[model samples]
Target: MTPAPIDIPDEIRAQVYVHALAAFPAECCGYLVGARAGVVDAVVACTNAQDQGAHPTHPERGADTGFVIAGAELLAFARAFDGDRPPRVVYHSHTNGRAYFSSVDQDLASGPAYPVQHLVVGVADGRVTEAALFAWSDNAYVEVARWQGPREGGSTA
Candidate 1:
């Protein structure tokens, strides 16, 4: 059965926006940790290892179009499932200002290397524009929630 939608608090969402903006022009990747099953309480910012030319499958692509969590961060993330506060959502940014899972994303998440949902942030012009949360359902990942970023000269409400 499909799992219930994970809950991301506003502050946590804001933190993600910040990470996305800070990595503008390049994709930022990270995960959300929760003490329980359905609600995330913290955001763990991770380095985007794509630009390091170490991405196992797509090293030719730069961070502008891809992201990979590797090395120490990856080890920690994998080990967290056995901890008290495990990650419930893995998040990444799209510098092209679109918040949909891409073909590469599908390939990486096919076997769902981890037991977590996905949050894709859309960023352009150095600011976050939109974000979408997806969860594995049936044989694919599907959108479960969405959040709109602050408009130009406006606030996030």
Candidate 2:
């Protein structure tokens, strides 16, 4: 069965958006470390590690359409976490456009690496157009929630 969707506050959403905007023209990826309780306590930016040209796996595809979280950095991040608070989400932005997960994303997320949620941000013109939460379940990636921005009545954006 699929898990319930995460309820993210507007402030946290804004932070991620800012990161994506700042990295415009280049996809930005990172890990969200926290409890399984589904609250994002921190957004740690990870190097995309995608070489601009001639990626080992798909030289033709190039780095513009891919991202790699350096294994060494990942190891150090896990070591620093103390095992109590583990990564709850893996997030990245589609710098050029489109919010949907690509086949490459599926191949990467399929590892069941951490069973954490996956968040994709849609960026265009240095602004976020759409963003959503996804999770790997059963044998595929499932959409969990779409960001609705701030709530009404001056909830803050």
lDDT of 2: 0.72
Tell me the RMSD of model 1 versus the true structure: 3.7
Candidate 2 residue-pair clash tally = 0
Which ten residues in a row are the worst by lDDT in model 2?
54-63
Number of the top lDDT candidate:
1
Model 1 pairs whose backbones collide: none
- The best candidate in terms of TM-score: 1
lDDT per residue for candidate 1 within 53-101, as digits (tens), equals 5444642243335568999999999999999999889999987787888
Candidate 2 residue spans exceeding 4 A from truth: 51-64, 80-82, 148-157
How does each model score on lDDT?
Answer: 0.82, 0.72
How far out, in Å, is residue 111 in model 1?
A: 1.7
Q: Residue 49 in candidate 1 has what lDDT?
A: 84
lDDT for 8 (candidate 2)? 60
The TM-score obtained by model 2 is 0.79
| Candidate 1, run of 10 with poorest lDDT | 55-64
